[model samples]
Target: MSSPSPKSPELSDHSKKYDRQIRLWGEHGQKSLERANICLINATAVGCEVIKNLILPGIGSFTIIDGNIVTEEDLGTNFYVEKEAIGASKSECCMRLLQELNPDVNGDYLDESIDSLLETRSEFFQSFDVVIASNIKEATLKNLSNLLWDYNIPLVYCRSLGFVGSIRLQFREHCVVEPHPDNKPLDLRIENPFTTLKEHLAVSEVNGKSPWVHVIHKHLVEWKKDHEGNPPKTYKEKNQFKEMIRIAMKSDEENHEEAIKAVNTVFESAGKISSNLSAIFNDEACQKLNTKDKNLQFWVIAKSMQDFIKTENNDLLPLQGVVPDMTADTDSYIKLQSIYRQKAMQDAENVYQRCLNTLLNIGMKNEIISENTVRLYCREASGLRFIRGTKIQSEYSDWDKSTTLAEGLECQQPLMELYAVLRAYDHFYTEFGYIPGESYVEPDTPKLKGLVTKLLQDWNIRHPVSDDMVYEICHYGGAEIHSISAFIGASAAQEVIKLLTQQYVPIDNTFLYSGITTETATYKF
Candidate 1:
């Protein structure tokens, strides 16, 4: 008798709970999220909203740091605290409510002000994977930014006041393995096939009835014969090449039609390095591999890739091991896909060996990087990203030398104007111990405008902040609108997830949202 068929494994509780999100980021990314320890400063509406989203996604744990007691105003803006919770610790209230969202997520609170924490237990901040600061004062923000920069911890500084909000991401350097870009083209290697791929294509039966990839390969080979062994490089040449495929169509087959459609993009992108990937390869970090620092695993793998390209791979990134769907029989498609997969596996193995050799050359333990991790890096080599962040202190200290701000003012961009007003609002709060319009909008308009003028002058910007914008800022009176907080908070949470999982691309540095215009913009400092 045949052995009993093995039953398919069932989903674990953790996987079942986060099934939807696991689908989004995959189990690897979900595990990263589940292992993350997030630290949030302040339990303001925006801050709670940020944690609320994170809690639902099953982040391992979170610590809320806020010394303030909840007030009636807090009740209006924050949904996490109730009337009974008034006069209680804001951090505790937020933690209690947020923890209820996901039992799998562990949470705690520190009823201490940020300034106090920085003074006494600054090292405490270093323990977290990421820190989210909301509605913090400018001086406090600079201090926290500097502290975290030294610790090399990523900080998401966000604020939601009135109808405008902004988020600034501060990190020394961040590397992303899987950007999960949309509609990424297949890596067919048609233009520059490897030995295995070329061998397969040479032997595969080629006809209109076969897969489009095989058809394209057959035609590309013939096209290369008459064109000095080079695939069509010019626009006119490509078009001529497409016409050649069109003429070879037999009885208007769908595979031939698909082949014709792919002619434009297939050769253009095949065997070419994207500018973004090229930039990553040329980055200073990748150029200078510091073997002493065990944490520089991304750069280590990147250096291995560089070496692999030079020595074994012939100056090309590893095959992505993917093929796009095309008109073809199941058997033909599977056979072609297996060839690509086999080549991809071999390339990954080569790079993995190189990584191991690099690690040993530096007298480091090979266990510092796992073989599985190296394979992941090789799979995502083409989409690798590295971000070098600027400190918030630098942006404030070097306002005069900022050409991006100057250009934005000259162009009269609405978001840039809003950014100016927000800076002036911070100044007003610092000088007067309250926001401009907290008491009365009409009385604070000129005062706020004066601060805006001073800020513009400091930056050497000749542009003026419109009176209408100043009035709008004062009318909001530093009040945190719940809806706006939720919007910005959700957005910030998304950025935080990107940082934690290192999957999707996070914003370069700054994200600005205007509730009035219902628009958002990102800028690099």
Candidate 2:
């Protein structure tokens, strides 16, 4: 096991330092990034490049394992390795340089190769939150992939060859909270106002401070009480609801734009739960959150919220604890905001203790969850997002579509040809112990031609890959190009930040970057 790291700076410190990013991803996402421990294997130019990005953003810690001695070639691309460090171990060189970027980002390095570590202490792999392995053999990558797969850890397999670079993520499953959705779900609860809100609206006297919002809410409550306590359901009933608002409006209140807007806007299909919330109710994770698993606060809270939705007469998700800016006076708006916020907190607390009982039922220890976690989940309950990713291994075995996939490729879409070559590249390196032309001084077209042909046959693909494409790859001498490595490194680092913070959607299974044309393409298998 790795040694413990110092706690990341507190939220107050985060606000002072990470103010900009906190605005972008919110404090919750910043916390996730700060808590994540990333592991990288082989500190090649690409690996260090990725590490560089994460360190700058203040990831909690990182551990790099590499056994190679730095060479003159390392100085060409790896910014982290200076000329003075040419003879040094690549892992140590990369770590020293990366630490200089962010003192808060604690890290260590292992001088042994990944293969040696895998042989002796494979369980050590389980200690990381995510793994980035670059410039590795296929068998070794697959071993790491499968090991991490079983443990539910995300594995980023990145490669850079010549002008081609690609990153394939092997994640069994991952859930993201901050999708940065364009449309944020709101928990207005307009149709089914809570007891407190209803009681506030029940008064006939507004004391001249009531905003048009309260006027409209009060009018609608009076109408519902006179009727069967249901909001407008049909077209005529909506018209009827509007008429009720119109009647409640005094002649001078006609100029009250808030009242006018509420009449036209507020009553449209107000009673039912949102379609998004309904979809959330159908999610398998919420349904499957039983006694066996109580570790995830989100899931545990979601499970409890599910029960709340079922049992509550409102039949709605919990209060989102938010009130929109209104036309009310300062006191009225603040009062309304406090009501919503306080009710949401009460609802949240009920779910929190309910889920705590669930944790106990699942045999969890005391205080396995915190009230703050429950509060966060409840506040974002309506805006909660779910993502289900396809497994990375699914992409490798689907080569039968290579013909169709290649057909979609316009001539010299280096990206299209790069994927094919990468597959064949894996085959060549595994059998020959080196990339296609890396060991030879001259272009080994014949050797490469045979390998490509064998790879196509194995995949049962008959599509023709131009001979020029094969030669171009061979001309690269199966060597990592500086610009290409840098591109993949930056891209991988961005995705890792997304993966850890989950603020933005991470690239789905595979991303191919071609320096030949400076473009990237995404594919799902």
Superposition error at 139 for model 1 (Å): 0.9
- Compared with the true structure, what per-residue lDDT tens digits does model 2 show for residues 1-525? 112245976667658888887788877788888999999999988888888888888899999999988899888878888889878888888898899998899989999988888889999988898999998887787667667877788888888878888898777555555566675644556667788887776663553346666766666677788778976667777667667666665655532445545554455533345564566668776666654432365577777877877786356666768665655566676777788899888888888878878778777654767888777766666555555565554555445456545564445465666677677677777877777777673556667777777776776666656777777777787577777887898899888887787566777778988776788898754
The 0-to-1 C-alpha lDDT of every candidate, in the order given, reads 0.85, 0.73
List the pairs of residues colliding in candidate 2. none
* RMSD in Å for model 1: 3.3
Compute the lDDT of residue 406 as modeled in candidate 1: 79
Model 2 residue 427 distance off true place after TM-score fit, in angstroms: 1.7
Off by over 4 Å in 2: 1-14, 199-296, 326-328, 383-417, 437-472, 479-484, 516-518
Candidate with maximal lDDT: 1
Worst 10 residues of 1 by lDDT: 1-10
- Give the lDDT of residue 482 in candidate 2: 75
Off by over 4 Å in 1: 1-10, 292-295
Residues 1-525, model 1: lDDT tens digits: 112245958999877888899889999899899899999999989999999999999999999999999999987889999899889898998899889998999999999999999999899987899999998888898899899988889999989988899999998888888889895666788888888778888898977558887888888889889988998888899888888888888786888888878877787665456787788778877777776542478877888888888887777888878877776777777777788888888888888888888878777788888878888887777778887778888887666455787798889888888888988888888898987888888888999999999988887788887888889988988789999999999999999999988889999888999999998999886
